[model samples]
Target chain A: MTARDQVPDGAATVWQRAVRARERADREEQLADKHEAIATETRTELHFRMAYIHRTTAARHRVTADLLEAHAVRTAEWTRRGGPPPLFMTGVAEACDTASVAVTLIDADSNQLAAAASDEPARHAQDLEYALGEGPARDAVAALVPVAASGTALRARWPGYGPAIESLGIGRVVAVPLQVPGDCVGALAVFDPRSATTDITRFVWVADALTRSFILGRDAGDGLLGEIDHRPEVHQAAGMVSVQMGCHVSDALELVKARAFADSRTVGEVARDIVAGLLKLG
Target chain B: MTLQEQELAAVFAQLTGEAARDPLDTQALLAALVESSRRLFGARGAIVQYTPGGAAAIQTDGTDGALQALAADAVGWREGPGHDARTTGCALIDVDVATHPTQVRWPRWSPRVLALGHGRVTALPLFSKDGPAGSLVLFTAPGSLLDERALKLSRSLADIAGHTLSLQREVSESRVLAGQLEHALSSRVVVEQAKGILAARHELTLEAAFARLRRYARSRQRKVADVAREVIEGRIELPTD
Candidate 1:
């Protein structure tokens, strides 16, 4: 099916979501004003803190609303022009002042459950991480915090993945964990971002928006606008290798990654070859 | 700032402070609301009937047992000014419990309120984004009536409390939904991996392997995902026919 056809909701629904976000932002702003007024009258530290909290929440909602509005506009343009579907991550990348952004949704154990990217470089970066079993995204998810590295620092942090991604001409990388209360669901990574854009506050806001509004929102059933690639073949290969070698699937998954890294290929490519009986590993 | 303004600011700080607390304590919030409203309006007693996200609660500010029991019964009976305010999403102020009209309106509740020595009552609607979520009822001594200023202040307090409660509920629901989405995604990944293992082991197609997994899970009265996990974990071995 065409990518445009894969969108779970029409532009109308996206616009509605944008409007709802704007309304929430307005409410939060009003609350912030109330708290600020009270704080001024009482000169109470508690009121000031409450005001700050409301203002922060209001800013987050405004960012989400702006992102949704941009997505809706792009979707409408695509609808009129009859082109490839507009990806949700494109707006996210633009908001971060970068052309390459990837989101990796992970399980509790930090294994990638699915991934989406704004461009091929971002996708390939995620693939390299998957195959090598290390990268900024993985570190962010594991640490539940933002991670950033540039130049030789990337290589120092991840010997195998750092050089490989640097070879792609990506000079810098930044990743922030997508966190909900009491749980970390995933991470968002940006590659070769503009200089000094990795201050991470804006990135954190975008990540929070993605976690709350897009991934867990009411229309989330559409599965991230159908852009997420689950890499089913990789998991399937892990299963096949587990049975072939009579080992647990988790170990089989590690073996698959090792094979991919040794052969200098993506885990997806290696998985496809194994699934087709063109390659075997014991 | 004037003395009254300072007092109002203190009340605002208390309510907002409680609202902004992490992992909000609903009981503490209710207590704060009751105490602030009673103190601000010079009422003898105050009760808060809050129902945020389908959970109903009623709390009073350390009042006598007989009065608390009557308030609890008022919620159940749905015959008091609080019930009227909640149902209509409007305030009922300066209501005299000893008046004939009040007695007729709340035949079972008014006389009992009078017997408790409260002559006047004021009920304010606690509003959320989704409409009225509950009510705050104040009981005052005989011949006392709240002026416009007091009513406005009480309304502001109720509004803040309602908004805070609803926001807390929304945050909790979002957290739950996020967890479920994560669980479902991981489960699907596990099941797909299991299918591959089964297919490779039995030299069968992926679809056939899935059927075998489902059949085995059903026979054992287990979830397919659970069976898939066991397969992936190497805890369950399926025989080749």
Candidate 2:
């Protein structure tokens, strides 16, 4: 058959075919664009969060803070995380609820913490893992693999309490680890009663953003939320400065921050040099 | 609750509920106000003039098309070069048959509005934190009944409409301005990055980096983007930095 004749013989009527073809094209283009975006955003979210910590201060904090606030409002699922998590988790839970999905981070040691539970029953169910000392979320953290359990089946696995969950009408559960740098601090879990969890791209984005943020905060160790500073890279760059100048990390930081201050710039500006291997510490 | 009171309360509650949704569509709301107020208040015809800081009123022969024509004529007045926010608020030219123009308190808006309509009219100022956002100027057919309930409802509608307009305006304007800010910051980031690279590559100061970029652009006859793209791409690195 000619190339035109090779078209499907009776896939659908002409009108149907056109509609289907248009739909398929739209779907493909949307999928492709979204696919590229998720990939770009996945990488950029980490970089951006790292950049943020190196940069965040009173003046520059407005946009990111507004964004974090909006994200909490946007996430509609986190209300159930029980009396709210720690302050950070409130925002995180807000984000999870907005997306109607799970978000989690585990610290260096495999401990269940820093979780914002959007679906309350899931939090209660998750506590089964913490209280009784067994659950897939913890396992996923240790294995660094996401865990999914169907509501129908999870009840059977937890036998004594699984039936209670079924009674509460909870449907599905999913947990993704907030992994970044050397530490995997916690995992976020989400559940829904009527729908199985999908559209996890948002939660994944949150996890990536917070993971890098958590590490940077931990490393700053200066009684500040470091990793989100966007200047930690400056600090890391300072580490490179210490190595190049044979000085202490603290001295290197002081020098960089001093230069930034002298010029009314941020520490990240000066630290970029040491990290890029282009400038030696003065 | 009594039946009549319950009905009134329910209506109030619904109006309050609808008022809460964000990004309240102002254009859709303007059209809705014209239709519903005309029907609810039994005006011969109504045109609720809406603007950024004020509004006007007009009378029609009990048809939307007549109202539409009157509104169109009013819009035509807006295009002339001299018209301003003040003139928009008080004018009364084509709104009714040549009635005595009342340029009393808000002279800017009052005189023009009287020329347009022939009726007993009231224009209430609508203000948000900023100054007046709009007004609720309704025309009653000469000698029509002005019941207290109807007056309160009309005033309430004006407050609700003005608040909604303010909110929508705030959201959209903020979104646009924020987008602009984000774009500027992103560009600043490029400038900042170029500054960083220049600072590192040439062991020169950041101000020095900027001067080098400016000097190179002046000498070579290239756009700033060409230079920035070069710095960012690592091709035409500013050695002067």
Candidate 3:
């Protein structure tokens, strides 16, 4: 037979045509025999993927909630355990993380703002700018709106913060502006040095969520202040990166940023190793 | 042909008959096509190009110089054997590059085929979803002919390759979305953990504890997650603000 005559029609072949026909017939027969089982398998696979996505989403929410919940839980533990009242800076610094944790309030002038930062050298790395009267947080506060630093491939945009931030080993971070409508004032900055994906897409989702929380928690602000434990490991890592890299504390902080991301390990874990003398940076 | 060759031909016909229409599945399709073609046609090298982009187009199994040249040249045809692919055009399938008739029909590409380790070449244009994706070409010694069966088999395999590529693109895009979702959730959990540490130590409300932490981070020049780790570690303590 000529090839044209032998070849079947369309996206399937002649033999496939027969197989598909038979399969369809058998499927109809099986539907009559066991329809529920087939449906169940389909349902099960769909549920598996849906559950995975849901679990991932919830995990993100839970961490943010945990920060809020820490207040009550830690207070009881401290009171129950009964230690001398922890120092205020110690408590606040410890609570700060790459997640949504730090705060920014406009100072007396209302035009300029001051920052209360966490102990993360990466996060603290940027506070130097606000301390020096310039940075994303400072601009966000003056602008009186949510400001962001989507630090991507080209980060020289933040001029002063860029080179300084680079030394802290941070690849990318975002500082969102928080202000009430009709009352443009200081802002809150949460610095997250992410190394997971190419973009700050996830960080943006989280920062947005935290900003909402800030707006919602505004009335509850005065009542929310609490004591936090100091995060020695992070500072220690910053110190180590500084010592090893022979850079300032800020530069040392940046070293941890690159290391934490490159190894896919947390800055904390790497810091632990440094403290224990398990690994060293080149 | 011998009985073995005929039997092999029959198996190929059956597979192509099955996928004669659809190129999506047909598992074990491409390798089978190559093996069958090599045996049936006594060819030296063959390329199956599907989804051709002039510059950005991606090809599978066409790691050869000729195919790369075709992509770079952006020409439709050169001479006796090569295939020229464009975004939109009549799919060209030249089954014999060294043959006299094809050699005379195309002037430029003929010598290039001789330069490439093969004396003969045939190029086929594959049309998928009614669009010009790319072409498939078979190369061989002077004795080889672009037989009907070999051409049919390679064409079918090319279809399968195209389907696989489409699926891969879909999968990669989904991964990007999934990664973003994961990142969002992790950051939230960390923030919450820091809050717990702050509240417990300072004897304050959760929100207030967060504010204090934010305040300290602003003052200390650090990241929020970085600060939270410290609060949990006791390196930097929080004050009751």
> Which has the better TM-score: candidate 1, or candidate 3?
1
Better of 1 and 3 by lDDT: 1
Residue pair clashes in candidate 1: none
What lDDT score belongs to each candidate, Candidate 1 first? 0.81, 0.45, 0.46
What's the DockQ of model 3?
0.01
Stretches of candidate 3 off by over 4 Å are: A1-282, B1-42, B48-86, B95-110, B117-120, B124-135, B140-144, B203-241
Please give the ranking of all candidate structures by lDDT, highest first, separated by commas. Answer: 1, 3, 2
| Shift in Å, residue B4, candidate 3 | 10
Among all candidates shown, the one with the greatest lDDT: 1
Model 1 lDDT tens row, A1-282: 255557645677788888988998998898789878977875755457657877887888888888878888988888888767788888889888899999998877787888999998998899899877799999998888899999889899999899999888898999999987666888999888786645689899988888877787665535363778878888899999988888888888899989988888888999999988898997
Q: Candidate 2 — what's its lDDT?
A: 0.45
Tens digits of per-residue lDDT for model 1, B85-142: 8778999988888989899899999988888888999999887767887788889999
TM-score computed on alpha carbons, candidate 2: 0.38
Scored against the native two-chain complex, candidate 1 gets a DockQ of: 0.54
Give fnat for candidate 1: 0.75
Cα lDDT of model 3 by residue, B36-131, tens digit? 544544456555444423354444343345645643342444232223542433444544556677567766666566667566565555444335
| TM-score, one value per model | 0.87, 0.38, 0.33
Q: Write the per-residue lDDT of candidate 2 for residues A1-282, one digit (tens) a residue.
A: 133332222212222323433443453344345434533654423223223332332112232233244433423223434342223333455555532333333334553322334345554555344433345567667777676677567766665435544555655666667554333556656555233444665555555554433223222121112111123345345444554565654465567656654554334455665566655656
